[model samples]
Target: MAAAKDAIKNRERLLASVILVSLICGWVAGLFKHHSDIAGFLKQALPGAVRFDSSEDNIYTGLTHAQSESKKAGFVAVRSAHGYAGPVTVAVGLDANGKIVNAVIVRHTELPAFFRRVTDNGFPGRFKGKDCSDQFEIGGDVDSVTGATVSLAALAEAVRVACSDIATGRLGLLPIVKNKPAIQFGLPEILLILLIVTGFAAYGKKLPANTYMKWVVLAASLVFIGFVLKRPISLININSLLVGYWPRWQNNVYWYLLLAVLLLPVILRGKTPYCSNICPFGATQEILIKLGGSRRQLPEKCSQFFKVLQRSLAWIAVMCALVFRNPAIITYEVSATFFTIIGQNWQFVLLALVLILSLFIARPWCNCLCPVRAVSDYVRLLRRGFTR
Candidate 1:
């Protein structure tokens, strides 16, 4: 009994340590990424425009005006809007006719790769010539970045808010339209629905030799869910849900489908087929283990340690997400690295290490570091407790 109590105490200390380290790392990373001060950001966002010293004539809320030295270049409003991760500030240049001359991102907390995708795909450029009259709906007037839907939507919202404020409050022009909802069903949504239905039908029932069926589902997940759709269940998605950044269900049916497939089974059956049968990364690791022809297991004590470590990592990740209110801060998973091929160098290195290690050990990442596994295990524990 004394040894058990000591083990529990040690586990609690380890958990506390992990949480502290994760929070510190997240704060430091945020500061490092956003080291370019607001002044520098404004300079890049509004070229050739000097900050106006006089604050007497400012009309729009949460904005500062800047104009060129020549006075013929018109004015720009530097404003900010709430984004997925945090505020996304931008400089919206306005012509004499109240039309947008140009817009530039001043600062944002979106993931760097997704932000790059938005810029590279000319997302900001689309704001040019748009005014208060234009409805900034994602599908109607603005095309969102394919993989970075939330980031793109945030950018669009920032531009729209800035432009509307300038046009209505300062320019004395009424907005031509109110905000419109962006909602539509497409191929991705259909595919997700089909996949979820198939998973529930196959795994939710008791059938003989279901192992072959699980293999088929795994292959489909690796191909369709991972490569084609590129929408693997990520820690980011989980964090977003926790932080109330739920994607609009009308436009984000795929997200809804994924969440349902992951959650519904766990709620009903105390486990999800996603981890064991449908996770693309798990499928890849299994394939590698088979091909490498090495099956090894850690000692019982080591395995127990790893299980504790896994739970601790998951706890730390959740705490970081809550503290930072930024999903990107907890993105230690390798799903994006494999599917999107766009992630930090450390993430790539980690992915490589995990794959190499999987040759000798079965599902090493799932056993040692997967937040999803930790969550599943917790849910199962709760179910067992309630049953007892």
Candidate 2:
């Protein structure tokens, strides 16, 4: 029995190492391919440019060729900003007068629906001929896209950063280095921290109000983290961090705080309090089960089969995101469908099925299909390996 257990541990660790190595290699190859594709995107941003000066970095100079003259057309700079899902990269074309001639999204991992909304609402066109120094803030100088504020902000920031690079380097503008922003500790962070602390403090205690407290925490998480903020930790965020696409810490304190809330407990105690006690979607299902007055659990064999399927799907999703270097590619998270009411047709259908099934089984989604649970399980496995 001991030998068998040791062999299984060795196999699991070896498989994990193989997967990690493959992901790194694939990410590196994708970077080279993406680099080759940027020149074409730059040309699209600056159509009149006949040629561009070669450079290894994100900044470049465009040249227009006449019969005997090669004159400087403008400068192009590429920059990326953290979006709702992942990084949004834009290539900005600046004329000699330090005005944006055009800007194009070179690459992005934003959700297709949000990206489409921005494009349909003429978001990029709003930046044309804008001065490089102009504050590209949404709802001020730039128009905001309804239902896509995060995407719009990210796209605008990408363009603004690129323009600032060109303005400071070539156009001789004063550097705009502001002091580092203070941590954004807001209602969301406060609420999340309170929920975690209260939940852990009350767990497994014999107090009469313990059950009631759990429900209260769940309800609060559902309302704030789900409907109001609409920023539940998802696979997209996890993949972003894993692939080195971290958001700005000061501007995204809630993001980092949520990650810590989810990860620290697992790292320290091998317990996942967030998913068990604070997941908005899990709360929704629990509420549905309570209201429907049915709590039928799946048979053990069937439950085991579904658990395996869930882990396999999660692994495949993560691997695809890493290899393609786009976290949003396989983001069919049902939480997005239930909370923000944002997702595709299929996601809505999946959400409906999960909700319907919740009336029969207790947390069908959490028990059978949640990617977060799968990730936590793998993390715990790693923890066990290291502890041993």
Candidate 3:
């Protein structure tokens, strides 16, 4: 028994080392190819400007297709802001008098569907002719994109900040003094906190009443976290962690709160509190299992095979995300589609299949495809390797 334990420990250490090395190698390779084409980005932001002068403080003077003595066409300012999944870099072009010529999304790690929805709805076009001093508030001056509110806020802020920098530094205007952002502690935050607290309170308790409480929490998670808020843990969160993409804390308190809730138990006890207790998708699957009366379990050999397949798919997904430096690249999770109702045709098909299979299979996606579970497993392995 001691010999078997030692062998198992050795294999786990080896697996941890391999996973770490792959992640490091992927990150390094991605760094070499991560630079955006600034010239192309500027051209898109400021059309009719043939040439750009030297950049000073991220502000580039745009020159028309005229002689050297010609007046400046405009200025392009580059800035980035925290989006829903990661940083969104934008280029804002402003005329001599400080009116916006155009705004273009240079690069972003946001969900591709949400970002595309914003762009397709003429979100950037609405910035044209706005003055540097104008408020770029999502619902105040700029119209909000439905389903992409966080992304819209980030893009708007990126443009606004860049414009402010240009106005004060290059255009010789006063600094735009804006009020500080208040902490957004609202219903969503309150509900999530309550749910997490309830989950932890009920953990490891054998009280009969706790069983009823468990069902209540799960139902609440399904309704609020999954449907109402449309914010469930996904691969994007894992990719963001690996890529060091942190959204702002003031307005995105729920984001940090969720991460802490998901990871704290794993780091402390090698337990996945989120999966068994707080995940809305997990709750959905459990409910499905209850309704379908699926007491079936996969055979030992089959379970092992599927587990290996799950780890491989997850590893490949994370590696691709790191190499490309875009969290949106890892969007195979069906939770996003089910909650947001915004995904590609294939994703919808996959969601339907998963739901249909949930009737008889009992949490097939959680057991055989969740990247979060794979990540949790990796964290547990590393923790055990270090502590033991």
Best by TM-score: 3
> TM-score ranking from best to worst?
3, 2, 1
lDDT of 3: 0.86
The residue-by-residue lDDT of candidate 1 on 1-388, one tens digit each, is: 9999878756756655555566556656544443345555444444545553313443212223343323533455666655555557787766657777678787666778778888899868778877656878777789867777767877887788777777876678886565554675787777667666656556765545566767777778888889987778876666667655665577567776777777777878877878877788888888888888987877789899989988778777766765666665666888778888878899899999999989989888888888878867765655554554
TM-scores of all predicted structures? 0.71, 0.90, 0.94
lDDT of 2 by residue, 79-192 (tens): 999998788888899999998889998788888976888999986877999999888888888888777888999998898889888999888898655333467677877887
Better of 2 and 3 by lDDT: 3
lDDT of each: 0.70, 0.83, 0.86
lDDT (Cα, 0-100) at 43 in candidate 3: 89
Instruction: Estimate, for each residue in 1-388, the C-alpha lDDT of model 3 and write its tens digit.
Output: 9999899889879988999999999988888875857999888888968889866587888998768876788999999998877899998999999999999888888888888989898978889999999889887888988889889998989988999999998999999876555788899999999999888766766446888878888899999999999999887887887877877678789988888888778989999668877899989988988899986777889889989988888898889888988877867889988988998899899889888788888788889888889888888888888888
**1 versus 3: better lDDT goes to:** 3
**Structure candidate 2, residue pairs in collision:** none
- Poorest 10 consecutive residues of model 3 by lDDT? 199-208
C-alpha RMSD of each candidate structure in angstroms: 5.9, 2.9, 1.9
Candidate 2 RMSD to the real structure? 2.9
